[model samples]
Target: MAPLHSKSHTSLGSRKSSIFNFIQQPPQPDVYYVGVDVGTGSARACIIDTNGIILGLSERPITRHELKANFITQNSTEIWNAICYCVKNCIRESGVDPEDVFGIGFDATCSLVAINEKTDEPMAVGPDFTDHKENIILWMDHRSVDETIEINSSGDKSLKYVGGQMSIEMELPKMKWLKHNMPGGINSCKFYDLADFLTHKATGSEARSYCSTVCKQGLVPPGVDGSTTGWSKEFLLSLDLEELVEDDFRRLGGIPDKNGTFLSAGDIVGKLTAKSAEELGLSTECIVGSGVIDAYAGWIGTVAGKVDNPTVSNKLDSKNNGTILTSCGRLAAVAGTSTCHIAMTKEPCFVQGVWGPYKDVMAKDYWLAEGGQSCTGALLAHVLAIHPASNELSHLAEASNLSKFDYLNLILENLVVDNKSRSVVSLAKHMFFYGDFHGNRSPIADPKMRASIIGQSMDSSVNDLAIQYFGACEFIAQQTRQIVEEMEKGGHEIDCIFMSGGQCRNGLLMRLLADCTGLPIVIPRYIDAAVVFGSAILGAVAAEEAVQEHIHKKGKSRRSSILETQRSQTSLNKVGSGVQLGDGQHSPYTAPTATASTTNMATLAYASTQTGSHHQFPTMTPMTEETDYFNQPPQKKPFSDEDDSEDEQTLSFGSKSNVQKGLSQKLGNLSLKPLTKTTDTSPGAKLWKVMEKMTGPGKVILPSDENHPDRKLLNAKYKIFLEQCYKQQEYRDLVDGVEAENIKG
Candidate 1:
């Protein structure tokens, strides 16, 4: 909530300056929101205000087990415990009273997690079957490749809703693989999408978000006709998954919740499930929220309600017919180990070669169009690690108390000074990297595709590494550019880009993106915890369930209450000749002729005044120039016939009026201010060293070996942070030199 400003009363001079300043403050101090994100690697939580200010954040990595190639799984026990720990740590760091935390929300990857509710045990969805008790089908796992093709061959009616084909990465295929591979598994257990599982874990409710089911599971959302809703038993039967259809789609999930519909953020996700709370060292009072898919959360954070004070035209108000338009083909690229290019549309339109036109997956009213490569940030890391210059960079980074990345950035910056013609984006000229390291996720959707590199050399110098790394970035941007272009051809229009997650933080990456895409990228100044922020906002919304009714009653035409306060200089004086301050006549003087005065207060008034040409006041005024500030006509944009024609039409819409096009669904707001500043010493740097020492010399992932680059070079921040737990050590200190204390929950 922002401070209300009265547009009617504000003077022209002060209004512009005051509006930006006022919106910075939250409307209420006690209100708090939390967002939690579970990526492939870790679960993180962020505490924020209505104004998107992050108060606190924490993260913990969940344990994962990889039984064989293309078979990735995680223990539910580990993931749930990690979630609890992160939530508690966020609460403690925010220093907000539990009562102040109004709501919470969750977002996770579209991974598959299975549990046996009846037996209270885990069912294995693995190859060797050793870990039958704790099994999950990770999104990246390609074990269901055959099962996916089999399902796709059915050409079921539901296939029309998921852009005409299902893939191994989606839920249905994974579920089928689980049922077929482990015969007793489906009979004994319950299946949950990771997002829904987090929500169920939090709220003790089995409600599934529309975003999850439609995009990943191919659940046919209730068409405008409503009769078409629910899973197609006939379709499942065709795929030999009749058991799942016979279960009334129970195993596939049916209870649906809309995106941004809150459950609980810091409130009880059913009293922390007792046993779970104990493991996290938290009380049952610590509330949890229903979770969302990670990319969906990123979408939410990027395109939640519009900012009150926009520097340029409030695109939110101007675009797509002036209603709060659901994003029209907005591309939300969640760049990390891989990049997910997510888009949404009003009606179902299947584009060949893209992942989805999944209904109600990203937003309730619109369908989602997701596309991405198998590798982005991850490929960059691989290229850097194999470079010969990596060891020299690592040694410098260690001695200088900086991460190798930061140290490399410094070197790049120095190089730019000498060769002014070359930009960071241009460094990729002689190098190219393939994104299909794992496989092409979208456009091609080919799991068999392998990585291809062009223009490699025997020389792996610092310059070579820099050029190669920069090329990897350009490749990602080009990939996104390609995705957006393909989306437009498929009846969706992508106007602007909203990026988040790991890669968005890099200046080089962002600049390259803006240049390549030719669209203004609006990066929110929120915490990088988009997942948690989105969840927290939803949780806040859920806690205030009555708000819907209240808003309905208030009608949809509610303008944000803009409270404007006037602060003008008022002087009192005696107008008599030779009058002194002690004169009895105290006449309040109102300066009629606005002559430019020496006072700073008067200077502001003169500056806002315009000349006949309608140009803004020059930065410096010559003494000879007449200070005709007084009697200067009010400076306003000259009214034109075009303006009058546009102004005649009322643009008011309902509170939930669809307005801006190309906005992401409400995911989460991340508090990323801390990451923006350069630090003398980074926790990531220290952790790498410690891990290096722990592993000892001759290790492939060493800090000092340039030829044998450490695995941390993969992204701006290594994915290892998602799992690496830091223990308190004297050597580990904050960049500010503060002793590393125990991370508070």
Candidate 2:
């Protein structure tokens, strides 16, 4: 069906950019979503449009179940058959139109997954792997290190926004080490949160994701519109683990959707189940929605200021006084293969070791926090696969067709052009890189911190693996300038740095994170599989479904053609420069910039009221699924765990001023309370506390040369040798001579 302006696939890895293809038309009161995500390895899928663009994309990879230690696992029937093989190969490479898609969503990696509830089957999480299809558990499996040190020695005020400590990576110390080592492996069990098990595997509706139970199961706490969100039951009986609050919490999800919906992340949590529309070929009248926690869909892929339209993220909201954030607080990081960061505020500040201020999970009434880094792109492909010039730079990057990280960014741009150090992070002035091999997920939330490397040189050239890949991008931008100086000492006034996963295309780790955290990072315009277009903007704000109405040439609807495309605006060009997809596979699609560019408005006034940020794309016809307008009226699968558990399942939530606020004001004990000083702080936290205690130790702020005096003496000889190798016993004595990852019980 597509073939009007045909070609669309953009991705960016090899930079083939272009757009303007609306799959054989599509523009009227537009609608089209699809998202997907999955993560700890792969399973993407994009297919966007309502002006957040994208159109068609696909990804597949997946395979993990690696056992032995930091054990990982999977197989929710192989991640729902790799999300039905990347959504039928991204709707056959996005010729789109399975009834113009409408919705779908999903985001994963909070990884726990177990199920049964009378024969829904799959439970076994692990144990010499007996396979009820491994039944997940993954999110970096740290086998509940002594039940995360007995739930962080039972302090449990929800362990202070998870920064005060509780590491075996969330979900109640991996369900208390899976009920003390699988004691009868949970019978009619039910645990989910691999993005609410792909939205209860396409809506039989097990209902969770208030962004996967408020950020990785610290168990709900963020919804503040007149309170009452449940589960604390005395912090689950102070960790004796109250069978996860039996019936009421319905296996960790305080049950709401038996056709109710409003759980969040842009609503609409049901539909699609005609056996997930014949295993995702699509169309049981689509609309699944509700799912998150793949770094909150990479913080809904950087939603920019004053709701600068990623299809108007529901005017962000504080009841449209509109502050889904823009002037300050924008962090996001999203680095990929490990590296999180996030940050959003307006209320709860928290900090401690840095996890969250939580609530409204990713985007809404705000307060998210996050901070991570359990290995950046798996420690940059294990520092370029334990380099010995990585097999002759992978056969000279496949004989120069490029891509061994784009031929290691063209061997650090031919050893930094005319040379006088204009960047390869200033030729690793004495290599330091301490990438935390697979630990340190924030401030010092230490999961047994390991990994370091100080000045090595027996010259194993390829320019010493590009100065050890620019010393792992200047020690991950000095561990993001020490996690933005512990989130500006836990108050977060954080001015600039939005970045977005997959190492925001390195341009030397974005200029060594703007010269080691001197802020100014930006990079938005939703490019490449942007966490499946931020899970298809949570399935176009969870599609309203009624076949997203159209009919009336005058009967008027498509919500008045989306209020006449939001009171129209026009201009065109640049949407057609991105082709290359007959299918040699590589199109995560890019082009969504309908107006952003603002930098020097009087030295960083960054203004974006979005004036004529380009618009008007109305043209029509060509939407297919064997059209007769998709031959309506046959949807029967509106959720059926055996016919909606024989109907009448009683599920009502909120209002009449519903003010319960869970058992005794649910916050988990509460303590973390710093961040509120505001007299204009966070220029990357006063440039990372004046480069950590008054720039004396190996001084930095080295870029933006004051006429390069050998680039300010090689940035003061590696800023006094990385401030005399910042301590805590040299990376905790190299993580006690490391040996962790062998996790599952």
Q: Which structure among the candidates has the greatest lDDT?
A: 2
Q: On residues 128-225, what C-alpha lDDT tens digit does candidate 1 reach at each position?
A: 66677557788878788788888888877666656567877788888887778786657766777887787676656566666677677766665533
What's the TM-score of every candidate structure?
0.66, 0.32
lDDT of each: 0.49, 0.54
Which residue ranges in model 1 land beyond 4 Å of their true spot?
1-19, 26-29, 128-132, 183-185, 224-229, 254-290, 305-313, 320-326, 399-435, 546-745
Best by TM-score: 1
lDDT by residue for model 2 (1-745), tens = 0000112112222111111111222233334567788776567676654444454666656678666778777788877887787777666654554545767788877878888778877877776546777877887787778877877787766667667776676777787777767757453577877877778778787666666666667754524422344456666767766777666556776534332222657467777776776677765656777877877676665634222112222222222322344423667677656668877776777777787667655544556778877777667767877988887876675565433554564555455553645555555666666767666777776665666678887889776886787677667777777788778887887766666543443445555565566655554433234466677767765663332353233325554454345336422111110112222221111111101111101011111122221222332323232211111111121211111110011000111001111111010111111111223332223112211111010001112333444335434644653554457457556665563432321
